[model samples]
Target chain A: MRLPKLFKRKASGEVAKDRLKILLISDRVNCSPEMLDLIKQDIARVISRYMMIDTENMEIQISKTGGYGIGSKNPSLYANIPILDLHKSS
Target chain B: MGEVIVITSGKGGVGKTTTTANVGTGLAAAGKKVVLIDTDIGLRNLDVVMGLENRIVYNLVDVVEGGCRVKQALIRDKRYPGLYLLPSAQTRDKSAVNESQMRKLVDQLREQFDYILLDCPAGIEQGFKNAIAGADRAIVVTTPEVSAIRDADRIIGLLEANSFQQIDLCINRMRYDMVKRGDMMTVEDVVDILSVNLLGVIPDDESVVVSTNQGEPLVGNHTLAGRAYRNVCMRLMGQDVPYMDLERSLSFWTRVTGIFHKSQEGRA
Candidate 1:
């Protein structure tokens, strides 16, 4: 007997975009959720290190992306870093 | 001393037993004295998967409970010279053994085998805890699905909490055709989400079902996914083999373009 086709339907042009943001709590220092937050925060912190502060209205966010491996050119990370300084002494 | 590696995942049916059987057979075929310990008590499938269920005279719990020595409980795999299996007790509860008890059991076996692969049970409960207690390292298995990844992430968190020195990931049952069609997540997505060293990726194949039904691992025979598992064993042995292309088929456009270019060259 012939096996029925597996995933033989017509392919579409649209692709799913996975939007994943893992929150970083101080105590949760490991796992995927923590790692995504670390990647985002490090980018924001790197930018903040070289610039002046406007902490009151500062916000940063990163959605998990998978088009490229973490070690290579991650244009998304570079694009998503918050441009404003996010540190304050208050 | 022989090393102990636990094949564990936080979710069920994510290919933990499959990994254990294949890795055990692969290592054994490579001339290492390998023993697979099925620690999934009350849900024993490793013996069945390995086709050693009918030959079981003693089990893991029996050794732990002092009913028999570890040697007496180990069943040798006939296909490979050095492969053995310490089957789990299907009738026992996970709570019957504690973490330290498992640690002692694996430690004793460590002196006798080149690699001891533990087939951990599902869930982050007593079975999971007991399975990891005796192992030196861990191999976390996950499917490309979100639920399996969520569970694997939790398992990785637990292992890190316990200070496991080495932990790796294996994304199994991956269907690259689905991934190309955007129907399933790619291995890259899984690696990015987990952020762990990838041991390897096993393509989803009907051969796996056939082999499991036959009570034999794909790695013990010739199959595409079986070769992937064989590569994984090599990687585990510190060989730097490149990962194979997970895509089952190039998009039709890609093949069409290749043919189009070739015919143009022929015209020239």
Candidate 2:
């Protein structure tokens, strides 16, 4: 919901929300968004060499995975790339 | 058994020390024997905030190093019968006291007082780690500003990772005027973001500055901030106290809008 603009400037609340979104995400991953994007691009590039993949529909995320041992729950990079026609493009 | 609570914020200048002083004093005033521990080490100020700075013959480092007994280091507050201060050593850094020493100190304090309040240092460093090491619960203090809230979120995560169960939030230095104008985050907005149990909200009051400067906790005074701290103390003791009426500072336009809506509802 938008409030009536009492003053002629962007609301501080809105500005805060925008900054917090990016900051919290980066803080969790311990990396910048640009770095995350670069990682995703590199993953896509490596996988496309051996398979005809639908890059537009691919999803890649780096997050902590659950495991049941000492220091076992390491961060894992998961990529779900749809193979449109595997080994057909090469 | 006594309870130990750590008051911490990831960012500095957010009034963790003030909250500790007021709440410790308020709890003591309610007849609960309480000891306030300053674990900020080199940056210790809870003693100054409680106005017990001059009484520090021994500090946390002394107790940890076996230089003095814990009782010897505890400076009793003459104003409140049950209140005491375990001031941190201004000469020592955060490295002087480790997590185990903090736990040992808190365990000893628990054997005496009914409440042990640890005033944590800012930042997610060794001091913060040591403060939460001995805490059974935590109070995350944050102002209504973005930087404070962001840091509070990080502190909450760290507390949870350390297996802290009861982490309550206190929104400090909130300006009702700014919230009404939609220029600042409201209490609800903060609660929604942090997703924690609300302990209390301390309105921005100039009396807080005067009280702090005078080395007096503002819990027992008739001022708005004092009343807020009193309510917080009651809430800590399992009492369901209603929040103070911050709406009294609402703008005229908001009241007018409310009246128009109410009139339309009556007609319908």
Candidate 3:
């Protein structure tokens, strides 16, 4: 019997690319992955106060846009928060 | 006026010195008046690499301190009529020279040479600061490994922060066979991650070791790395030279052996 695909190893090059993508993003923004998590939680808390949101599935990250040229890259925050319902304002 | 360029890498042992020596020699061989300034200070090695260690009478610190004339400290390469070296001080540390002093020295040399290549020391410290202080352009060198790539990214970010408009990347010691086997990152992968203009890619060749041991830059010879360095020099001169085709340059016997190895792996 063959082992499951999940047991197969990833190509080292692909692993390097994946690692660098996240590492570079963090390095560029001067924000650690743990710091990003805190920011994500804060965002979720603020959104939850106004609406019912899927905190478990919310995603937040800092990414770069614009040309890859030196001094041209612009870092911006991206968030994906799922909302199930809206709360009535008091 | 000559253009001042610094060859730097955040991490050590990534071929910054080798690239500086070869590129400087290559440019000189092309009939351009070039001066290579070793700014590593205290950990000086460029002099030995260029085989001019014994000729060093006065060093960078001496010139900066007014202990010697800038012209007096420069050691000319006998092999190239237009090539010279400003050796770093072996007895002093990075703090021996500061930013304005470096700017002044480079400014002085600018009127004389056609190109000024600064071989920057490793790390982002006083030495690094002094190296980039006088540079108009920066060439960041890196290997395909994760540590080197991470450091390169950091260096690029630092260079961008310094308002450098002409930063380029040189990927060194690339192993084509490993890249073909999916064991190493390709040049495209590195370029995509670094996001800097590709200056050139040097293959991992044993001849580079031989050349360095002989105190010679590989630009004059016909080795793979030598050819790559020549292409880099051409690119620096604003010539449109295509990147070397490493795959096609492989020997037929090596290609056949590669196929046989792949078949063995398939059977497993």
Higher-scoring candidate on DockQ, 1 or 3: 3
What TM-score, over all chains together, does every model reach?
0.75, 0.80, 0.91
DockQ of 2: 0.28
User: DockQ numbers for every candidate?
Assistant: 0.09, 0.28, 0.76
State which docking tier applies to candidate 1: incorrect
- Give me the runs in candidate 3 sitting further than 4 Å from their true place: A1-7, A49-51, A85-90, B252-268
Model 1: residues with Cα > 4 Å off, grouped in runs: A1-90, B248-268
Give per-residue CA lDDT, model 2, range B140-223, as digits (tens): 999988889889978987887787878899999989887776678889878766778899999898989999899989785656
The CAPRI category of model 3 is medium
For residue B47, give model 3's deviation from the true position in Å. Answer: 1.1
Q: In model 3, what is the error at residue B194, expressed in angstroms?
A: 1.4
lDDT of each: 0.77, 0.84, 0.89
lDDT by residue (tens digit), candidate 1, A41-83? 6655666667644443444443334443223212132233333
State which candidate has the highest DockQ: 3
Which whole-number lDDT from 0 to 100 does residue B12 have in model 1?
98
